[model samples]
Target: MNASRKLTLAAAALALTVGGGLAVSSASAEPAAASRSLVTTTAWAKVAANGQILGGQGITGINKFGIGRYNIGTAAGLNGCALLGTINTNGGNDPGPGSSSILVGQVNGNTLFIRTATPSAAGSAAVDSDRPFSITVVCP
Candidate 1:
């Protein structure tokens, strides 16, 4: 299949999964509410190109090592978590224009490493660039 088709399918699946989870959680009663503490395992962060933390939940600190490189500290360890991130091109709290890409990974149990890049003029390679981004991490 083509990349567009694969991306479409993946997005649809994610939407369904998130929608279903929200439905199930919202429908549960008091007993289930007690177990909702487990939901705290999810964390998120919005950071600027200068590594300033704009807003986030369960995020402790954000450090900029250099251009296009950052380390995010979380309130809890993320030993077995799924990390997702995307560049922020929308102008607002985190303002930036043009297209960019981001890469997120776990550097340690409680730290996540992020790298940002922009496509080269020839569109043949990616060059490291400073860009704002948002990230989400879900741990089990």
Candidate 2:
């Protein structure tokens, strides 16, 4: 993994996440959810038909069916609203529809989907590589 790939959250937010705690004030406790920003990309590690990593490219946007957030690593933010998970599939790779890529962050909370695309340099697979790939999360 990229060591420099640090999340851009502030110290308080980082602490809240690490401590598995939530700071919901009376105002935040009201019937409402925060407007979360999704962090999705289409540049992921390339995987084989059996879900093996062959190579990869840069990520782009969130998947078309990015849903819900999961707490695979943190607990301070929304219960199902963070983009922190990993998925192991490419768009239209299965017989039906999902690649079944897993993700982090809780669903319906602050979750986000990250889709990656293959690089143009990878020959033969380049066409297939340009497809959308899903990422669940690689929690920090």
Candidate 3:
């Protein structure tokens, strides 16, 4: 089997063993459910100086968390300039009732900043390598 599938199976088996053991020893004899969650999304796009939405992405998780990525193709703009953009959960629910978002990771760019739910505040002194970026948002 593939590495990804093997890892997933191993995790499930471990959860069952631990959870099942706890329940069997107790009066209820019902396995407790695991609550740990992990979600990931990846997208690719050729962003412009003004900022634009990234296409070709996927999401997998419980809630529809707002995530975005942009490519600031120019290197002669202010680092704090705000541009119009949108965050998409790709038909998923919002992160929470009042949860906020922030930048978690970045690459192939001089600097990438995400505030609130936009990615237009990025700035770089030099040209960016323009590679695909992945974002992961954890919700309570």
> Which candidate has the top score in lDDT?
1
| Residue pairs of candidate 1 with colliding backbone atoms | none
Model 1, TM vs. native: 0.63
Candidate 3: pairs in clash: 64-93
1-140, model 2: which lDDT tens digit per residue? 33222322243367677885444443433223567765543233443333333554333223333122211212223333224333343554532232233323334433332333333334454322223233333322
User: Per model, how many backbone clashes are there?
Assistant: 0, 51, 1
Point to the candidate with the largest TM-score.
1
lDDT by residue for model 1 over 24-81, one digit each (tens)? Answer: 2323321233344254447898888888888899998888998799999998889878
Better of 2 and 3 by TM-score: 3
Evaluate model 3: give its lDDT.
Answer: 0.34
Kindly report which residue stretches of model 1 are placed more than 4 angstroms away from their true locations once superposed: 1-41, 90-98, 121-126
lDDT, candidate 3, 1-140, per-residue tens: 87765665566678787884322223333446766855322222222222333432222111212233342322323233322233334344333223233443332232334333322334441222222233332222
Candidate 2 to truth, TM: 0.20
